[model samples]
Target: MIMQKGKVKIAAVGLGNRTCKYLRYVEEHGESAELVAVVDPDPSKADWAREAFSLSSEHCFRSFDELAASGLQLDACIIGTPDLYHHELAVAAMRSGWHVLLEKPMGQTEEQCRDIVEVSAETGRIVTVCYILRYHPYFMKLNELSSDPRMGKILSIKHIERVGKDRTAHTFVRGPWNMKEMNTTVFFTKCCHDVDFVLWLTGGQVESVKSEKGTRIFTSADAPAGAADRCVRCAVEQGCPYSAVDLYLRRKDWIKGFVAQPGESQEDMILRMLDESRYGRCVYCCPENDVIDRQSVVMEMADGVKAEVVMECVTDEKDRYTVIECENAVITGDESSIEVTYKDSSVPQEKYDFQWTRGMEFHAGADHQVVKEFIDSIASGELQTRTPSSEALASHLICFRAEK
Candidate 1:
């Protein structure tokens, strides 16, 4: 939690990996932002935040309700809670006179999102959703080039989000987002960024939408014969790409959520956890997983721009590729670079580069930019971010409708 002028103190709710990523902004800009408090249900995470930020024990709370009861005077709060708690946490922070930087999808339902907007307006508090991809430089450039006079105007957009198989297995089929009872649809949990990118590029209201979705694989019928309930005990796991043993044991990555306890080795920690953990479940045997592995949506914007979005969870790599067809030219980008081809035969193609260097940073530095903008807005007394709740709500509405 931070702003530059007067060193605005910020609080954090839900001390997860995403929360830590945003707090990196405060860590670098100590002169501008102050980490006054942190709240999380996990005691270990609370301890980590307290030690890292030098926060007083009193400032570490287990819940937002507890923090509110303490009557702390914080200028802002960053909420990284789960889907079910976004509405309650955001509303509470705003009502308590603190601006908010909330992670998306901001709410699980349209009414919840509308309530966030209404409450922010009602309390005169600012709420910015974390739609970081739209802030990516490659996309920002694409937005500019699409409206160039030489290119004419944007007429339609076709975008695809490839949620690579590893991520699909880790986060969707066997993770927190696997079941409908626990979280929202894959569109909200995973692809709201894609939907919002469409709206931001077109700068128009979605008029109508038609969509279709289904699970292509990872169903019980798709399971290989002799598969065990848990990967550790499975006979066919050695060659399975989705094998938890290969990913968590041999690879030793994506362990942020399953860290080893004191005196525990990484292998032992992973095996012990996976023995009964959902992460170790056979992807094809997850009886409770309801998320579709693929979805396609066609949206008609009020500006007469058509946007087509496809999400594929069975891909080998996770990435977003977009094509913008203008009246005179067509533009395409895949994070690495952008290319434009003139509709006229004699015209040459134009290329712009972003260099694909974001792996070391969060979302290729968009996270830092977004956090900095939030702070700058606070410093300038504007109380607005590029992805303010009102604008983010437009994109979220499309996701909610498409889910229907």
Candidate 2:
């Protein structure tokens, strides 16, 4: 499928709703790439691709293996399958001499991640793991600030990622990545990008991680007796908060409404969000609901810097927060003083905010930037690639360790 034009022939392996993110990238930057093929087990999605993206009928594949054996001479393949299927699909793509753009977390475990890395090495093919944060301009600014000498040696860091209760029920308790056991670990699945960002920003490895998780709220008991499986049929649909059908309707912020919010809600918003969206179904009432609703972790970077992070599936909605502490700073009794003494009692405090700055022409999100850079690098043979697979693998190892 090689052509004289600027297009790089590529195949997309998944067509879930999330694929919209990648599709937007292609539509906006189609000159650099072409939808050479579309692969998905779902016939509807494949048909949608043909009609929506002008993909030829011959280009839609029923499975990754079918596409791999198609001899289409593809330049690359993007693997957007569910978390559990990432490693195998990526390996198959790389082994077949097609460059791969794997979604975050890389793989489920360190061993599987290593296997992918080994395969990439053996094939001499590029494997770019998508850790969108690396390409985020806001984080890029943070990195610049950290690099400054006046910042004076970052000694500690704190980060928190909170989601409302409505969100928890939709993604964890009901979504495909819901189960915590095998499909995806919360830390690896949800926070791998952040872990990678920490490593990238600090330029250090995670020496150790101590994490704790629990299902603090959103239980099946909340559902009516025998109202199992489908929440739509349950008589409690109108009364119970967090009803799936209701959540969907209220997800206007997701579909058309402006203030830009995820369909999921934090713990505080659970009750209020109940029956606000379609996700409120008593899905958790079934035996398959196993994802963690709350989690916290503390880690020691290889540089001896200690960092604490908490990701709670809360009932309230708040933006992500990151604060860095510099141990080298001294509080001159007048700079916002809170009287301090000497010895170990003089634990000084100074805060630097790393909150993301809003407004950008193409904040297609960090993941899109990562994909763009990877493809650009591959086409131009630029030696520099942001969020390379090996570095992403290290972050995955830290996450895998945390999950364990």
Q: Which candidate's lDDT is highest?
A: 1
Mind giving the per-residue lDDT tens digits that candidate 2 earns over 1-404? 22234676788998865555676687778878877899998886787789889988889999988887788988788888888888989998988888888877678777899998899878877888877667766666556655556557767767666666666666766666677666766656777777776676678767789998876354666556656455556676666555665665444322211112346454434433433433444764646666677777788987888777677775566345566665543211111121212224455543433233343334437657777776776667552466667777877777777877
Tell me how far the alpha carbon of residue 328 in candidate 1 is from the true structure, in angstroms, after superposition: 1.2
Error of 1 at 354 (Å): 2.6
Error of 2 at 360 (Å): 7.3
Q: Residue 326 in candidate 2 has what lDDT?
A: 56
In the range 1-404, model 1's lDDT, one tens digit per residue, is: 34345876899999887889999989999988899999998998987888899899999999888999998888899999888898889998998999999999888889999999999889988898999887777778887898788988889999999888888899898888887777888867788888888887788878998888965588888899998888988999998989988888888867779856789997888988789788878888788888888888899988899999999898886788899999999999887789998989799899987776546478778888888888778866878678889888887888878877
Superposed Cα deviation of residue 339, candidate 1 (Å): 1.0
Give the best candidate by TM-score: 1
> What is the alpha-carbon lDDT of model 2 when measured against the actual structure?
0.67
